[model samples]
Target: MTTNTEPALHKSLGTLQLWGIAVGLVISGEYFGWSFGWASAGTLGFMVTAIFIAAMYACFIFSFTELTTSIPHAGGPFEYSRRAFGPVGGYLAGFATLVEFVFAPPAISLAIGAYLNVQFPALDPKIAALGAYLVFMGLNIVGVQIAATFELFVTLVAIFELLVFMGVVSPGFSVANFVKGGWSGEDAFSLASVPGMFAAIPFAIWFFLAIEGVAMAAEEARDPKRSIPIAYIAGILTLVVLAIGVMLFAGGAGDWTQLANINDPLPQAMKLIVGDNSGWLHMLVWLGLFGLIASFHGIILGYSRQIFALSRAGYLPELLGRVHPKFRTPHLAILAGGIVGIAAIFSDELITFGGQTLTANIVTMSVFGAIVMYILSMASLFKLRATEPGLPRSFRAPGFPVVPGFALLAAVVCLVAMTYYNPLIAGVFVGLMALGYLYFLATRSRRAVRAATAV
Candidate 1:
């Protein structure tokens, strides 16, 4: 219960709405991005990577729920780390969370634009991406209830569409298709496949990347102690099932290679089964936008809250902490994050490194931030358990020590794997972090001097 003078977030979100936000924050992965893993590891190898990532998420979310319930702040990992380790720890967590939330939306927005381009051949995907930013930022600013409700609707539609896709493609699914050349160009697992599996770590992570973002909304949850655990537990379960189902079904529907490296794999897989002009294929292209929209919109919500939280704590400029007087939303924070996302969208073609597009690079960079934050958040959980034994926790993580320890270990392994596989992106992530840290130190020193003068 860290109190602040800034306007508070509205408590309109319940368990179901929180569940929606949790799922919506990550549903886009079910649409695309994860397919790139196939290019690295093939279907079977990627599946193993995905399952490992899912287990990490399951443990992380269960453990993270205790922090969310006991502390219940919009800063999420930032608040937890700050409580555990002080200002520098808080700054690192906040910066990483900001990077994760801000960069994620651009990737999803570009995907939204690509999905739109399939329907409108002449419309520039960049323009569509910018338009999406404007629309969703406005929606988020107008009100949280409206935004959360819309998120729930789109998330439900997105889930239904995924189910529809699996059913339609099930008839075409075959074990032979899925396992053919599945292990990094071999039919069975071998030591040679390990590199591909490691290479595919980032994509496997994409399957459940932003689910922890639900903690960012804990301050707005009506009954966080009870609602959060239920929402988080259910949300992770739902996403794990969908991620596995979508990957397996799509891979088995046709030549798995055809689905790999493509943004709209579901439609392409369906086209193989039902012909090019099948209504199902067309429907998937159109309705699939809901998945992208859900993630894009929900991430806007997440980034704004993180920005607001950090600013309110004096980690960022005070202007961004202000809630809209009428709307009770972090309007400036929302707009600030939107500007960053739009800039990334516009730079899609301009920013290329190692033959990867801005979206691909940013996705890796975002995962870099997420893994760092996960490690710190788990560390904070362990620290607090030892230091603050009296903290009220409505739900404790099952199998503590072992569970969260596994999560921490997995996150560290993922970070090492990603850095090794994506050296350029890793460098960029580190560079940005260094710049942010410099700013944090400068601002903190100034604040300390001012406090000393007053004393």
Candidate 2:
């Protein structure tokens, strides 16, 4: 299982596969996560926060593309930061990626159970969720092409489903419904609502949670220097359109209160307009499965690669990095992630401590990872630009210092906001991160000692 260099992941992903990887990793966000934003900040408040977050993501993606294309490493952020600031930076970046990619899918997996519950009332969602983990991981273990092709297929169906949803729900769209209690019953400009806006940042983030996962597939892409940037740019734009459309239509079709605290927002909206027995409601309940599966399966692909990368670099257990000789896939890494994801499903109820459900806390922690990775990766970009001016570049970030600088600043602000408003979740997330980083240090120390003893 120990590898001194990158293990061969089949380089079969072309531009469409790369695009599917990016969009599929994030399509579920448009379906469910954003609803929690309404609970936190009201409709308009979430929009305000979401707009700011979207701008930050655009900047981050542009900057992330430069790093991924130039470096073209499966380790994604870890590889970039390691090159710039060495081991400490690399560990932090990789651990953050774990938090983002690993934690996020379980949350979505739970949502999958919730979706299935609509179709089969007798089935326990948690058990269903655990089953999903087994099925998707099995698919992932078989090979990358099979997994990525499944991702592309489901993502297209999900996208078409979204457009049909927009058409079905659009007739009932209303500014009045959307702005009903738009401040969550707080005074419109009051200081009280400010924290809610900050808290909603995590959920709004769900709208594009794993779009950066496109970079995780860089190692497996053909002509990544060109394909990677194309996938990222197109993926973000596609997500933006879908996010706004789904939010406006769903939020407007029903009471914001009804939509705010549910995982099945689109179907709920359809039920409101078309009634429970309507054909459209049934369409939503089933086809909506594609959106959830797209993200659930794609993010699995992303997390396994991050785990494989970390293990390959000797930052984690070597056994977790092994590629299956026959499948040419990171078999152990996918299995390990699947195990963690199942455990997360059972622990999903542990975070209802302060009016925050397990899903809310999980979403916050994932965003915490995204923030940490973004800040460090942007800093690493700046460091590399200054230290290695003559480095070869196939693609330079469009706005250069300004884009990365803004992305870093935005991430810093979001970090402070999340910590200030949701201290419990933030504290727990930081503690987990510290433990991971310490493990990396201890592993390095032992390796150093062994090398010296041999000498």
Candidate 3:
């Protein structure tokens, strides 16, 4: 008697899906919060932080391009690690990543709720949060094709919204805003506040946090080796340019303080510049909302798939491994992810890595998880290359061991820096990772026992 192996299902994401993940992760709702951090950093600090963040992201993308092309499987980093380092390493990489994605949607949904609350004081955060989850959950559960289409629409609108804000608000910007003092308190111009600039660098770092989604989408990309590299390079360059444009536009506007405080700074900046009488600001607001929604959908798509992939590999429960028969989607995992976001309504408010004053507890948790996963993935790259030089690389990271080496170093530095600055929330992240690793060890012991019994 022989056992039959399960057949594998493949995803061939087109340019649209490719852009969906790329733009979605880069042009995030997180930016709304990031602007405050950048403004507080002042011009030079902002520029420096932006460069550091961009370079780090480039390294990650380049490294992932190599790994993604080789495996080109659904597991993303999880699959790459399993192939290179075996099951335990894969589990850790995948587990850390799952924690991030599972918890992130709620944080993003909370952002939507927070923004909606600004316009509608009566809008309950919970209700708005739940609504956001349903819309995106439905999109994911329905299928990737529909989700991809929706993401395309949302990203397009987001681009238009950003362009409109930039075009309309340019004339209203005052150079004086850039020179204002105490960017954090009114002492920004004071030499004593120099630390504030260093404090502000993390904000830029936070903006570039999720830019790795393009490489993560390797499993679904139409051509992993080719598409992954193109998406990684083109997507990042486009986003960095856009980010610089937004920063310059904001800096040029007279009162950085005003932009820093507003929930949706671009629309408010447009209002301040062009006057509230213009209907375009409202249109831009709606478009911006659409952009946020698009971001929401894209993350859910990518994150849920990450979970499904890991689950299929036996690192998670099989339920998460199920693909909807009709929709060809990860229904259970998508639902599970949305539920976490829905639960985040009850969680505390937590400050984000960006200099922003606050974010939902869930979002902060996800950000921390993402950071941890990045560190793991980068380290894995270094370890795998050293341990398995003979392995074929369809795409190679430029600068040899230097690229992966630097990425690992950057990951360590950022983690330490983020922890130093935001110990409170950062502590929470550490706690979660500790708990996850423990669970990993526990499960492994049980599996070992089972294997022995079978023998």
Candidate 4:
């Protein structure tokens, strides 16, 4: 079979840059979205859920590294599933990844707008969100090295700001404040609390949603086999610490309920310590934008690469596959994803359901996509291990069946919980996937006919 020829992405990323991409893609979760879990699960309940979700990510990343190092494809899970289960599996994985990478940005962009609104209360958040999409999309189209360098800078600053937040709020930290209404309703866990904890699964998963996107950069990494494992391991450890620390300090600062359901949770938590006019609060509002920007910018890089790979493989429009000749980046793919995000930003008020804003709904939808991709990717690992035993693997998944088994089982539980709590949004996700599958079937049939006619 003849394959499509496409321009190669420049190979300029090293371990540090790849680590930046991996962590930066997810750092924003420490800023805002996860706080919503407090609304459903409260402090103690959410913490329990977060720990479970964190363990699942650790297992998933460890096993996922094996596939990334073995194949080193920009398609990531899509390529792995295709090799293991053929075209149908590839289509499902690719579409799920696209849903994840594409939906996540609008949420981050809205958070960026919310942060900017803290600095300039009169500015409309949607307009600021639109501006963010424009600036970062242009940056990503310029070059991979330039984009990765900027991601590293912002990620480091974001990490520093988080540490500062912990230090500044440490004086007010009290175990009593954190444990008040710790469960969903009452102080202690009960049958009622279980539903709330399950409903909070998506919010907990948000902390590590796009971390797997690191695999999308494997093709552009220098010495991918060595660097991919290092980046994935170090990146997860960094995020897990920051996620737990930030959540604990913020919850203890004041009434945890006040921080729930808002995009500027950090600034609000800081305001409880220093007055609203204090320099510390203002500083957080300013530097906090870097965390949102890092994820916003990095995910744009991620989604574009997914689009480029799928298009190059004859799954999406060919225009999206073309790399810019001068810049050697996926220009059209970047712009295409940006357009979808901008439209979602405009629909912020229109898309709400169950009293949650567009940001929360979008976050749930993105988590749904990520969980599905995790299941398929783990299944691919088992299938490939059995069928292609000779495939060169620089790094092997430790405990093989046990580790991947736990990851896959956890992902299934999360999916069931999310679908139950979010029936409407879940339906929308299913509808989108069904539409994409129809396109895949139509194009595939045409390709088969053309190949036979030429023969």
**lDDT computed for candidate 1:** 0.90
**Candidate 4 positional error at 167, Å:** 0.6
Q: Write the per-residue lDDT of candidate 2 for residues 1-455, one digit (tens) a residue.
A: 22344468889999999999899999999888789988889888888898898999999999988889888878999889988998888888999998899999888988898888988989998998998999999999899999999999999999999999999988888988887778755536677777788889889888988898888899899899989888999999999888888878887897868877777888888888888888888888789999999999999999999999888777889788789999999989998888887888888456565677777778888889988899998998899989988887788988788988899999999989888888888888889888887787779975454335552
Please give the lDDT score at residue 355 for candidate 4. 79
lDDT (10s digit) by residue, model 3, range 119-139:
677998668878988877887
lDDT of 1 by residue, 1-455 (tens): 43434479899899999999999999999998888889889999999999999999999998999999988899999999999998889999999999999999998888888888877879998899999999999999999999999999999999999999999999988989999999997998999999999999988888898898889999898889889899899999999999999988998988989877766777778887888888888899889999999999999999999999988777888789899999999999999999988888777555567766667777887899999999999999999999999988888888999999999999999999998889888888888889998888878965464335552
Candidates 2 and 3 compared: the better one by TM-score is: 2
**TM-scores of the models, in the order given:** 0.97, 0.96, 0.88, 0.97
Residue 308, model 1, lDDT: 96
lDDT of 1 at 410: 98
Using TM-score as the measure, name the better of candidate 1 and candidate 2.
Answer: 1
lDDT of each: 0.90, 0.87, 0.66, 0.92
Pick the winner on lDDT between candidates 1 and 3.
1
Q: lDDT of candidate 3?
A: 0.66
- Record all residue pairs in model 1 with backbone atoms less than 3 Å apart, i.e. clashing: none
Give me the candidate number with maximum lDDT: 4
